[model samples]
Target: MSWLTIARWDARAVLRDRWFISVAGAFGSLVIAAALVALGSVDVLGVSAFGRVAATLIHLGMLFIPLIGLTVGAVWIAGERESGSLVLLLSQPVERRTVFSAKYLGVAWGMTGAVAVGFGAAGLLLALRAGTDRIPAFLWLVVLSSLLALAMLATGFLISAGSPSRSRALGTALLVWLALVIVSDLGILGTAMILRLPAWAVLVLGSLNPVSAFRLAAIVGITGSADLTGPVGLYAADRLGFAGLLGALVLILAAWTGGAYLLGRKRFLEAVEG
Candidate 1:
């Protein structure tokens, strides 16, 4: 089987799904709405209005994109297995790896498309209203958000490969999201506070979370200074600077995406052969 053909078919299938459509629509609406809301934020002398919008975009994009990628991906394999479709598909002439990789490609394309539309619309709105000075930062928001989505997709795909049913995959996906996005950040911060960790140490702790990696990149892009992120930001600004931090955070995300996909692929292959 041509993996490209399967990938394209899967992308079309994802686009046609009502749940994905609704979620993408909501994400797009939120992006535009966030830009509009950020316009009301007070702009300091040196900062462009679009910079403020980028901040809001970062928060909203990070929050929702992970949900979109993970929840859908979590069911990609498990749902088919539960319905007995996966067995039928595996019996075809196509190799298991083709199906595994192709499905991921198709789904990734769908999620990436959604992220682009949402962030692109927000960027355009900001450019029109606040001028284009911060367009680069807005672009960074899109790129970082897309990376985070892909990383989350990899994680959810791993979960799907091992899960027995859609319900369990979904429940597990939610817990993963909660742990990475919410609990990890809060727990790290509280630990830093109680331990009186230095700014550099807090920065290290934050980078371990994928969401925080995206946030670090976003803060550097939008504000041109990590100080906007408070104490950790302050240290990042002095020690690592923009290029350093952005590169580091992006690498972290890339590692997660690659590592999870490799593990998921191994499990999926075993599942097919079993």
Candidate 2:
């Protein structure tokens, strides 16, 4: 019951699941379709218009990554718990944290591989059709955007591992995502309407949401737009520098995964012994 063994088992399970394959195919196609369509409208990916392309790719990443990650990772722990397999698996000599961490890492590896394939394919298509100007930005879109997807997946697994029931876990994950998408704007709009908040305050609220943070970060990565890369939104790489941003994302993601695993471990103990 080593960590490597646990990861191997999780990876094999995910690969055997039919749904994972379908999800990968569907998401990859959607991204490629959107990027190609955007390319058609603009026809050029010059430095002058890099911002625009970057913005489009950012929007695509924001939309697709969360949707895919949330759905795929929502059932990771809950599904096993549902069938009593989680407890059985945990009954072995392995530590609960090891099992939890290994599963999280294993699922992440599968997701990363699938996304890389799909995005890489899309990049190739864009390259072949759009010529040289768009290549660099397009490639960046593929790589950086995948990072966002991975983060969302980590969050989803956190929710799944924390909740007792599969339905509750997935519901929580979806609600969290919805809140991230709409609550920020709604809160700002409500404050603006009710309290007559200052424009600056409302703007700040909009930028603080993680969804907005990731979106802005992706956009900044793609566009390098000085104006768009305002102080708001957590860029994939924060202003602190590339190493800093990577460290930040990794820490944040690790916190979420760790939190989820701890929660799941507690739940597993309660369910079996209670």
Candidate 3:
């Protein structure tokens, strides 16, 4: 009946899921190990240790953000619904909106924590190895990483809520991820081929993809450089500054989350009664 009650239940459900813990643990360990290896190979003495640390965190965080966000979050609710547990939970005295909000908060918070651990582990290793390169970027890394994670989780939650079946929700989520990562590049390539445009044109279009923006944001935030040179990379270099790209990512992600929620809100209600 109460929002707090639903929040508690949602938290309990997420905590009990072995899948969430297993994936989080594996990812966190792998990222931390990779960062340590990188740090060991680089020369840190008399170098900007703070900058190295920041760059490392951002670099590693970029790879994991979307994976954690979409892959893990997408299935949270849809899986429950497919298993018939979501309906059983809602059939309790809890309000539907409250149930949705609580579940969102639980999963979002849980995911954010997982990402923080992964990034934090990487940061610690960098510190131990590099002593610190650009410390300021650490602040940016934390804030941006959290937002990135939230964006992923929220999008997944929305899709899960709206889909008629778990398979559909997961398929759509994976498709969206693929489109963000690889499809955008393919689209640019296809367009450039058909249009016979200048090389710069292809470069520009690829940079505009949200995934490119996120990658550039991570690079710029950590290294204080944007070296986009080949295909989509070059376009990113020309189009976005460090701040501009991050701002764009925030805006685009917000739109995705908001739109998903709007659709989910309607779909959940319809499905509940049906």
Identify the leading candidate in terms of TM-score: 1
Model 3 ranges with Cα > 4 A deviation: 42-63, 196-209, 228-242
lDDT for predicted candidate 2 compared with the true structure: 0.65
Give lDDT per model, in order: 0.84, 0.65, 0.67
Q: Could you give the C-alpha RMSD of every candidate to the true structure, in order shown?
A: 2.4, 4.3, 3.5
TM-score of 3: 0.80
Candidate 1 residue-wise lDDT, 207-268, digit = tens:
87888888887787767777677877777767876788778889999998999899999999
Q: So what's the TM-score on candidate 1?
A: 0.92
Query: Residue by residue across 93-174, what tens digits does model 3's lDDT show?
Result: 8778777777777777777776777777776766666666544566567667777677767777767776767788878888
The best candidate by lDDT is 1
Better of 1 and 2 by lDDT: 1
- The reply for model 1, stretches above 4 Å from the true place, is 40-47, 194-200
- Each candidate structure's TM-score, on Cα atoms with residue i matched to residue i, is 0.92, 0.76, 0.80
For residue 120, what is the lDDT in candidate 1? 86
